[model samples]
Target: MILDSDTTKVISILGNDYTIKAPEGQEQALMDAVTMLKSALSETKRSYPTLIGDRLLVLAALNLCSKQVELQRQHAEELSRYEEQVSATVEVIEKTIAQG
Candidate 1:
């Protein structure tokens, strides 16, 4: 099935047709990526792609790793801020406690 007004190429995987809109002349690249992903997913002897299959696992792992790196950076920043706040609060609290 093809959509008339979409710039995206239609790719069929796991019996479902997905229309992806890519930049001009990038359809082939998209197709190539899909092919690679599908081939990776085909190890289970099924024509259709499985979400829980090995290929999917690898893809998910790659994506998760990328996200994890980003999250770690953000977490480090947050931790720095929190530590500064705690240090300031401790300094104030220590002065008050000593005064008492």
Candidate 2:
């Protein structure tokens, strides 16, 4: 189903219902993100049963954010490597054309 920008979806997380607004065709992506968050929260809860409410959410957010940062860093490094390879390939092609 397609959802407009104003569409609100009610999703359950941590035993609570939340109304979230998302763009069209992105409902599944939003739900998937929420599922990941729920998993993180659940795992954190299991490791630290004493943590509750805001603290638990914060910890989960921190964990997800850390992972995101690391992934982004890795992605940037890979992109840089690809760009260098492309540049070298272009230079080699230019040299071949000049020698031909």
Candidate 3:
């Protein structure tokens, strides 16, 4: 199947086969995401033995979401810090230019 120049690939997670589609040049990223999810599911299953089906899936989703949130927060903080540094440098440059 092709949509907006996307390509389809088959992947298996937990023995279940799935068809995934991604835009051109993004197939590797899509596969990486699948790998991450499979790893998360494995970790969840190992942590909570006896959990199967929806329960296990829910836990894995929660874990993945929590990690994504944390990463977003950290990225925001780093971006803000970078912006501040850039602003300070610009200010210094302006001051030097005005004094020259």
> What lDDT tens digits, residue by residue, belong to model 3 across residues 1-100?
7447888999986677889888899999998988898899999999999998778879999999999999999999999999999999999999999999
TM-score of each: 0.39, 0.89, 0.84
In candidate 3, what residue range of length 10 has the lowest lDDT sum?
12-21
Q: Is candidate 1 or candidate 2 better by lDDT?
A: 2
Judged by TM-score relative to the true structure, which candidate is superior, 1 or 2?
A: 2
Query: Which regions of candidate 1 deviate over 4 angstroms?
Result: 1-6, 44-100
| Candidate 1 residue lDDT tens string, 1-100 | 9655536678887677888897777777888888766665564335335455455656654665676899999999999999999999999999999999
lDDT of 2: 0.92
Candidate 1, pairs of clashing residues: 8-20, 8-21
Model 2 lowest lDDT segment of ten: 2-11
Q: For candidate 3, report its TM-score.
A: 0.84
- The CA lDDT of each predicted structure is 0.72, 0.92, 0.91
Deviation of model 3 at 67, angstroms: 0.7
lDDT of 2 by residue, 1-100 (tens): 9634666899887678999887878888998999999999999999999999889999999999999999999999999999999999999999999999
What is the Å distance of residue 62 in model 3 from its true position? 1.4
